[model samples]
Target chain A: MRVIVRTVSELCITAGTLIVLFVAYVLFWTGVKADNEMHDQIDQLQRQWSASATVHPTTKASATAAAPAKPAAYHYGKPFAIMYIPRFGFTWNKPVLEGTGTDVLKKGLAHYARTAQLGQVGNFAVAGHRRTYGDPFLDFPKLRKGDAIVLTDGTTWFTYRIDKGPYKTVPTDVEVIDPVPRKSGYTRPGRYLTLTTCDPEWGHSHRLIVWAHLDSTQPVETGRPKALRR
Target chain B: MYGWIWRHLPGNAWVRALLSLVLVLAVVYVLFQYVFPWAEPLLPFNDVTVDNQ
Candidate 1:
């Protein structure tokens, strides 16, 4: 009988230790892993940018060109741009990949494939994790209207100014990513940006959405946009 | 159970304790490197996308 009690207590201790280790894995280990992945994605994009001259960098002469150049097709699961939110922090930036798949997000922010490409006429939607995986959007609730979200495609800088959210909505509200999201208070189609992240910081039962409009576009030859100048 | 392992280890008490510590460290390394990563996506906290993705 005494041996049985001892065995049970030993088993309980082992199980308890494992549970604690698992929690540590979720909180600390994943962050370390994701931080490495995000950096790798950024490095890959920068390398490609330097190696390839196919992408036409917008210049002062081309800024007023008659027609906007069509962006190249986005390759799936590939990092294509770097996004910055000064509101998040001066050093806050993440690689924006092509799709929102589970595997894609582990690297960095994901661009919803169905939406408009960055700086295009329609909506450009992106999603990032709010809690785990380096907590990329952990400060999501701190986003406010009029904040600027900037992106660079290794060619042009697209500065989008927030107009509508940090709006809260359910995950099923697929319409939130519409070109002119109705809840976002836009009347007609325009160059827009939608940032979506899981709500509650620690859960995904709801989503936090933010809407922005393309405020300005300039060539990378020019310095960082005014919104990011500080 | 830990007690059973301790009893069966082919060493004196001090040596047995050292072996047990090594075993625990090995288990932790495996959990951190392989098991945790494989299990992360299966858990719910990483679910950040909409549309059940």
Candidate 2:
């Protein structure tokens, strides 16, 4: 009888230890791995941007002459833009990668493939993790109605204003990314950006969304814009 | 169960300890690489969504 009790206690101890370790792996180790990978991706993007900058030193001149065209075709899982939220912080920046697949999200914010391209006439939607995997959007709730979401595709800086939301909705709310989102207060089609992340911080039960409108755009060679200056 | 495992592990104290350590590591590795990934979809991690209603 004593031996049976001892064995049961030992088994309980083992199970408890395993549970703790698993939690650590999910909440901590994944973040460490993701942070490392995101930094590496950011570095690779910067290198590519500099190389292209040298090749197209005349890009600014052409940009001023021509109407803003669609962004370059994005390869899946590739880092295409660097998103900066001034309201998040002065140093808050995240790489915007293509695709919302699980693998792509592990690296950084992902662009919803079905949505409009960045800085385009329609909605450009994006998704990121709220709790784990570096918790890129952990502070997403803090965004005010007029917050600035600045994005750069290594050539042009696009500034989007918080026109609506930090609205809460379920994950299946696909209409939120529509060309004219039904409840987003816009009646006509226009340039918009939407950011989505899991709500409640530690649970994936719902999604928190923030909608923004394209306020301005400028060539990168012209230096930082007034939105980023402050 | 503990007694059965202890009896089956043929070695001195150090050898038994090393073997137990390796077994624990193997279990952890399997859980992380295979079991976790397989079970992730069923967990409450990614199912949030609303249809076009």
TM-scores of the models, in the given order? Answer: 0.92, 0.88
Runs of candidate 1 with Cα error greater than 4 angstroms are: A53-61, A65-68, B11-15
- Candidate 2: which stretches are off by over 4 Å? A1-4, A65-67, B2-11, B47-53
Candidate 2 CAPRI-style tier: acceptable
Q: Residue B1 lDDT in model 1?
A: 70
Tell me what fraction of the real C-alpha contacts between chains A and B each candidate also makes. Answer: 0.71, 0.36
Q: Write the per-residue lDDT of candidate 1 for residues A1-230, one digit (tens) a residue.
A: 99899988888998899899999988988889889999999999998987664554434346631224567999889999999999989999999999889889889999999999989899999999998889999999998889999999887789899998789888899899898899999989899999999888887789999999988888777778898887
Two-chain DockQ for each candidate model: 0.69, 0.36
True contacts kept of 2: 0.36
**Quality class of the docking in candidate 1, CAPRI style:** medium
